[model samples]
Target chain A: MPKTIEEINAKIKAGKAVVVNAEEVIGIVREKGIARSAVDIDVVTTGTFAPMCSSGIYFNIGHSKPRIKLEAARTYLNDVPAYSGFAAIDIMLGATALPESDPRNKIHPGDFNYGGGHVIEELVSGKDVCLSAATYGTDCYPRKKLETWINIRDLNDAVLYNFRNAYQNYNVAVNVSDKTIYTYLGILKPRMGNAVYCCAGQLSPLLNDPWYKTIGIGTRVFLGGGSGYIAWPGTQFNPSVPRTEAGIPKRGAATLSLIGDLKNMQPRWLRGVSMQGYGVSLSVGVGIPIPVLNEEILAHTAVTDDDIPATIIDYSRDYPQNLPDVLGEVTYAQLRSGRIRFNNRDIPTASLSSYSRALEIANILKEWMNQGAFLLSQPVTPLPGIESGLAFKPLNYRPVERNNSS
Target chain B: MKVSRKIVLHFPARLVEEAIAYRLVKEYNLQFNILKASIIPDSEGFIVLELTGEQEDYDRGVRFLTKIGVNIEALSQNVVRNEDKCTHCGACLTVCPTGAFEIEPGTRRVLFMHDRCIACSMCLKACPPRAMELHF
Candidate 1:
């Protein structure tokens, strides 16, 4: 029988629960089998530290004297534009948001010293940011403009409300074109000499719970070194991708929208990243606890690097127009070997994800659970696992027919 | 043995106009590539070149130069990366000709093998955080 949430909580408080990280539990289950391990282990922890481009933070800055209820406003944080989509002083700054001075669209990489990512890291590190905003004067609150410096302490609700984070799987990028291409995939060597993949592999949360059995709404997590929770199903949560017999997606699939506090986060786990020739992104550290509700959950945690494999893609083929070709499928163990063979030669690989940081986050969560400071919460709702995929309708521009009488 | 070495060839002030490069290849059968040369205009002269040739011919070429009072010294400048400042972003990985920078499987930290480094100094510019430094 599966252990109840109350039982797990009481066991944690009494310091009698068996909690092991996903990587460690895999070894234990391999020796004892899932049937035996499920009855023994109470929870499994999974972690990852990767650059998240679709991330942002919202802050409610303190009001300046005279209460600027300005009709229109523009603002910037560390040279990057912070969208003024909210009331008076609340703003949301995205990781990839660039300065107005930059002339880059989505295709070209802009050469800039700092971006939104740096501003977020500076705030987490307790550094002040140069905040500048201009507004048109209003009748009730007549403040035309304001420029000052502010830190995390000066904000009321400095919450990291990232819309998307933690991909289930990612593509291994390489350059087949003659010219070196700069992308979020990092700089790829010409003719596929080097390939880069970003993921914690065995330690990734979504990979651990591939089917979303035990991970869902209300699940408490370690986000950016602070305690956080999953807000909703992440944008682009495509569960319709082809899967292995183990149910893990062979390509990029599920993602999680996360919300956390800026005050509790640490600068060490939150670093600013700039992909040369590309845009800026934030390195987010996240860890989620998977409750061992039954033997099924144990089976998921038992999955290791050898059990998970992803295809190597030639990114030079404009994804939709030409479609990326699968060079070959290799297990995570082989990918982590530092080199993999494709065609006739061995190509060196680099990871955009930090394996060391992932391990650190996992261990930190283990200590928290063992000390009874953290408790497991049953998911309020299970994630969608529909077999069908979502689609968009095409535009129609045909002329109206009037039986040739008009 | 066939070998390549970065050497500085010191020339006497009077030999500044001598065709030493042509004589080394034609007379001594030495294969050389000039890396740097600053024959001071009408003054003391010197040239830096990577010399490669057969063991006997290399010996003969060195002897010929030394007999004429031309000094030679191996270049010693190298690339150094500060572990404390390196963020291990791996931007320097692609530009390295000798594969000196590699990721450790266990920690995912970029490992710098000084022995494999050729001191090309390409990584010095590729590094975003400016962690790489050239030491002479």
Candidate 2:
């Protein structure tokens, strides 16, 4: 007995829907079989909590006393530079943006203590942030310099619009060279001393709906502990990547562009991260609910860590050089076991993504739906699938020819 | 009752030239292994080391060092993890030389054993949220 979004919503409205998290669905499917579980389960919630670098927030800081034209001005939020090219008093700040005083990697493994991510976190936490802008004076708007403290409450509109986030799959980073390398995946010790992989595996939303069966544009999700929407297919979205028999991508593939109200977010779910050598980034919590429309969708949600394989890549060599060669392959089960066997060496494995936090998020979303406070929303349009022939292309570094002969 | 513990010693400028560690060896009959040290002429210095001696002798030796203006404190007291700040991401698990951090079985929660930590300070940099803090 297949279900529909309309049927699921009716059940949710009447407080009769059966909602389970991704972790619980695995056991349910094993105990009741896919056919029976599909009829029993109405929704399966998934979650992920990890550093998402390609995220930013745009906010309209209302207006100044003298109405300075901020569109043509230099803007900063708590010492970190922000983009003010949009409209008057509107500024955008990226998670990775750094202040001018940041030493960067000059001092090996620089301590990026504070940056745009911290500013975002502080704003969401209800802390006052310093906003300063300097612009060339205009006839209509004479003010050129403005400095003030702004809070999320004072802002007219603040939106968290991430261009790319919630990666479906990623590489297990390791360093085979003699020197340690600091990367966004965390520090990779020399001679493959440690392996760092980031992903929630089965609890990840995209992994539960491989091939974009239930998740798509306009899909509602729990973002930063609040309701959000999938704005579009994330940047570097490559559906043409090779996949397993179950349709799970073996490498970094697929992502989501998310949008939500910044004022409604929580400090716990939206954390500011300072990656020792690798600047700054935001750790966002995202959870999506997959309406059990059919047995196939229910079976996909049952995929566990053992069923998903991740490719191991050497960050010291191949990753920096952009080479496609992979060291080997390992399953999420091996990663979670604390140690993985690679080239006859037992290397310790760690995750930048928090499995416990992911589970908590999944549980929270499940509670929301089970209590009939949250309702499932159907996507207005489907994302590009494997048949879309979409390819993630690299930039071609070519010099522009000068027409000096003319 | 022989006891072994890691402690840090701070020496003033006047005591920098004195054979302080030698006094521990000869007078107190204590064995010391220096883990890390920073000393400069005519300046205050500090040393991190493991001291082994009899329980009574160890107490007396520490009292003697304190009497001589040498500040003594446990090495483990310098390192601490902020519970509220930690998201339990497990980033400190691999970089930790002493394997002080572990993910609990079943619950997947990251557990930090302070007794197992050697104060290597690798976790302070490896932790994304800066959860591991150093008081020194």
Candidate 3:
């Protein structure tokens, strides 16, 4: 019998909802089969904790006594620069934004220890951050220089508004060159000494809800240890990638843009990450609930790590040059085994994503639903899926028109 | 009683050129294995090594180094892994020369084995959260 989201909500409200995490759902489906499991389970929760670089936070820094226009000012939070293109006291700090003085690989594999991600983590942890700004004086707003300590509670509103996060799948990074390479995937040893992949496999959000069946805009989620919502299909949300028989993408595919209040977020779930040679990024924890409304959704939740394939990419050559080359393909199950056979050589593998944390988040979300503290919401509008023909295009370089004024 | 101690020796600028390993072997009958060393001529330097010998000889070897102005400390004291900070993401597993990190079979949890760690400090930079810290 097919169920609607309304029916699922009723079960959740009345404490009759059968909620299980993505990991547990796999076993249940194998035991009872999808047909029977679909009726037994009401929701399957998914989670992922990894360094999502395309993430940021925005806030309204209440007006000062003399009102300095932040839009025209250069503002820095704890030495990391931020975007102040909005109102006088509005600011948006990206997770990867580095300070002007950051060497940034100038010394070859530079140490980018702190950035906007660290500032955001500190703010969420209730630490006071140094807010400094310099601007040209205006008649209405005379204060040109401002320096203050700002806490999360002091701000009128602090929001985590990431543009792209929770990637459906990603590549396994390796280095084929003679020398080692430092990348966001961590250090890739020379000659494919090691491989690095970032994903929670069966526990990942989009992997469980492949094709965006139940995960869409307005979908409630467990973000940064707090409740958040899916704002829209994430940036570069391409659904045209090659897929497996079960409809899961074989490469990096769907993503989600999320929005949540930062005040109640926990530091453990929102951590600042520093990769050698690579700039800082935020390790965000995102959990999505899949309403088991039908057998199809239950079958999707039953997909295991062996069914998910990841493309192996050479970071030293193919990646930096934007070359369309794939070294090999391996399954998440092989990756999690700690060793992968690539080019007849046994290479150790590591993951940037924490599977344990992802499991923890999924369990927490499941508990929330079982306790009737959380309810599933139907998508206001579905994301562009495979039928939409949405294609992800790269930037084409062109000469800038320097003398437009002439 | 035989004893093996992994220690770090800080050599002063003048003592940088001293054949300390030779002295430990020839004079104190201690077998020394240099794990790592960073020394530049006429500059302060340090060497990490494992010294094994009779307990009495090991104590005398340490006293002799101390008498010669060689600052000695345990190798484990220099490298530290903060349990609270470690998200156990396994970034350090591949980069480490010695297999200091092992993923538990079922849980997939990364366990940091400090005993096998040579204090290479490779994990310090590779760790996203900077969980693996080096004090010295």
Candidate 4:
């Protein structure tokens, strides 16, 4: 039988309910060895363009010319806290374009064009929230970095607590290029054909040394910056790659891979594939320790620019095209011969940042489990209705302005 | 005018038949009453729960369960939809614990009723085609 609301309230007020100290709960998680659980990260991106202005509107009609023109920008960012055995995060990056080629400099007269950026607000904890910048370098703003700390043992609790607290400080920095405003009929107009670029990246890094080794983990290389171009009309220019400190080309085609001990890997458990819409796909995989599956070991491998033919005998493979028949035949022969264990299909490359985040979260959770500080909480309600696999959401970080001039 | 809040306590479906649910009620001296106690199958497996009490009581009840090694999460009212990218695989059908999905007879596409969804995310893991997504 359901207790009356009044009675429940009275019990709560009387302190008769079970209340465990936060530290005690942490201790319980550590003792339970729940940190060995692996964390998976996923990322996604969507893009849209600013609509073209009507010819009559640009020329100004007989009645009254509009002064300010507004464009509708449709974008969304989704972040879901860890509910069950898994947690997910999602973010959407978007922008508007200002063209350089136009007969009548209607919009703004400036040497450089303009593009819009996105801002993300996250709820970190029940009481404390933090906002991080989601956008990188652009004409108006410098490149921004986002950072987050996860409590591995109590991942579910920590995530929910952090999300609520982190969201309170949400603010995104907008870029405004210095351009002369041109007006017609007392209204300012933006130049036609000007374009803006928007991009998103996924980062998931497997921290378990054993897992890393099993999957052939490689060195952590930072891919430099680049603007993302939508494959739609009204795009003023092609996406430009951001430069790196080593003067390496920031943008271009690239291939990455993980190689390690394949003997003890659980290929069947690996699931799904996703990619960054704007930039090169950042793909990652980790190997499980042989003796203890809970222990993850980072692997060592090399990602080359050369288009190497897929090796049929490898434990797992990810490629953009079909493998050579010889390699495929060899791989099949090896599988039948018990030379390799390949249970899952090929997983495509994903966003580098999203993969990195997932790895980081997984590693932290593992550590917490090792310390017996992690615990799995039951859900009060069922999971969400949508079927999109657990998507990884990025942390939104913004820059804080310092009043140095004072 | 004063606003009154109710709290509810929920137990997992697996523990419903066991004495644990009753023990929790007796030990805690909880005023909350069990609403629905049953075992339900989800994508991950089976889960049991006992829904009892008001909103405030619910929050307190979660804390109480947390003390006993049971986890609790709040439910939000949000409708999620997949854009045109969905490939229409039937993976989501098996994951819906509440029987929220129905097949459109003509198209054979899966139709979703948000009201019945418990949001356990079993279908997301079961999907092989990389379609089917959740909206905020």
Top model number, lDDT: 2
Q: What is the DockQ score of candidate 1, to 2 decimals?
A: 0.21
Candidate 1 residues A121-202, lDDT tens each?
A: 8899999998888888777768877788988987899998778888888877777778767667666788887887778888
A305: Cα error in model 1, Å: 1.6
Candidate 1: list runs displaced more than 4 Å: A102-110, A320-325, A387-406, B1-95, B114-136
Give the true-contact fraction for every prediction, in order: 0.14, 0.86, 0.82, 0.05
- The lDDT values for all models are 0.79, 0.93, 0.92, 0.24
* iRMS per model in Å: 3.0, 0.5, 0.7, 18.0
Candidate 2 lDDT by residue in tens digits, A1-406 = 8888999999998999999999999999999999999999999999999999999999998767788878878899999999999867789999999999889989898999999999999999999999988999888788999999999999999999999999989999999999988999999999999999999998999999998999999999999989899999999998888899989999888999999999999989999999988889999999999999999999999999998999999999899999989999999999999999989999999999999999999999999998898899999999999888998998888999999999
How far residue A154's Cα lies from its native spot in candidate 4, in Å, is 56
Which run of 10 residues does model 1 chain B get worst, by summed lDDT?
A: B122-131
DockQ, each predicted model: 0.21, 0.71, 0.70, 0.03
Q: Write the per-residue lDDT of candidate 4 for residues A68-167, one digit (tens) a residue.
A: 1111111111221111111112222121122223122343332111121111011111112221223333343333333233212222221100000000
Which parts of model 3 have CA positions greater than 4 angstroms off?
Answer: A401-406, B1-4, B8-54, B60-77
Chain B vs. true chain B: TM-score per candidate: 0.62, 0.63, 0.67, 0.43
Clashes of 4: 125
> What is the per-residue lDDT of model 3 for residues A198-280, given as tens digits with 9 covering 90 to 100?
99999999999898889999999999989999999999998999999889898899999999999979999999999999889
